[model samples]
Target: MLTQLNHIRARRADLRRDIDVVHSFEAWEESCVPSYCHPNWLAAYVSWIRLFRAAELARTIVPAPARILDFGSSVGELGHLVSEGGAGYDFVESDQHSADYLVSRLPGARRVTLEDAPEGGYDQLFAIDSLEHNENYAELLEVLAGKLAPGGVLILSGPTENRLYRLGRRIAGFDGHYHETTIYAIEAVAERLLARRAVRQVLPVAPLFRISAWARKS
Candidate 1:
């Protein structure tokens, strides 16, 4: 148990270092305003940390060199970390401006639209913070799951059904426009996924503000 705990700590340290490297990139700096809408570096930093942790959790299920698809990859922030382990990363972004920006930021990663996504199926699929934004989340999840390879893993991260996150956002003065709508309960989503038998393993990630689910395809 101690060894496992130490390993988790080491992994977190590595993720932090990776996020630091991402912050140092010229493209990351250039895309800040368009991505976050303002120059709130602290908020952006926290976002990166959350994304990094999500990616790390995904890595535990889907190892390196696997094909990865990031749905609604705004500016490809999480894609950067997921792609680092020699994975074939492809991202879908509906917003043309954000898609175009990602082209320069994520050089090798493929920038695709929902329609243009490859049919071959991906070994790992990420929908970090994207599910909450969609009203037709159930349909979207089904569509995404259909595109996953057999035994592939799906990683989802979003704000929990807690008011504290909203309060914190207000206190931090972060942009609230995108978060105006209600977010679905993370546990409800997980239960739905389990009921469908689409995923064999549905593991929940920690950190109360945001919750991550690692679901291995059945």
Candidate 2:
């Protein structure tokens, strides 16, 4: 069942998603950053390839599902990969331009209605590089915690601002980009947050400096 709105927003207000910072590809399209980021997401592909590793970790834990919700998904990059893995997924994006490109892939992606997400209990939920966009990151996590099915898993990947990825860029010489809540230390910090939130597990399996945790509701 979906959580109530005002209460949910109020709960979301308590969390702070400060920077810990920091994905792959179909054809490089300005509208679809996720697909454009695909090739760069996997290991040994992009120059700074930890992003790809993040996707890998998520793929490893998220089992095949009848229904999947790819939150903040851009142009279905990882969504398509998961689909190929034998799971059906629904890509959710707030931006219509990007969502339009994603729909080209599925030919059925509906526009995200902010009041509530696509209905039904999904087996999997993913929010990559997305939490910071919320008030900080807490509100987003609260919503995510409420979204999962009893045993479903939610995968979140992001940088803790300026700290995690920028230092990595020094050695790699990649240009620094902007991210709201980037963290250089995710393993310890994220593990703590996940535990308090009542998430069943916190697995940091990635080449990326941030985090990719699998939270299951029991």
TM-score of model 2 vs. true structure: 0.59
Candidate 1 structure, TM-score to reference: 0.68
Best by lDDT: 1
lDDT of 2 by residue, 1-218 (tens): 13323322332232112111121122223222422222233321232233344445555665556667777775555554455532466666766655765666566544454246643366667776665545446655655556666556666666543444456545443443334454333223445444322221112342344445555423
- For model 1, residues 1-218, the per-residue Cα lDDT tens digits are 37534543454454344444345443333232322422455454455556656666666666663788988886676666777632488988776665775666567888766666765478778887776666677777767766677666677666653566667566655444454233345436555663222221112332334534445434
Candidate 1 Cα errors over 4 Å, as ranges: 1-42, 85-87, 175-177, 180-187, 194-208
The C-alpha TM-scores of every prediction are 0.68, 0.59
Residue 170, candidate 1: how far off, in angstroms?
0.9
Global local distance difference test of model 1: 0.58
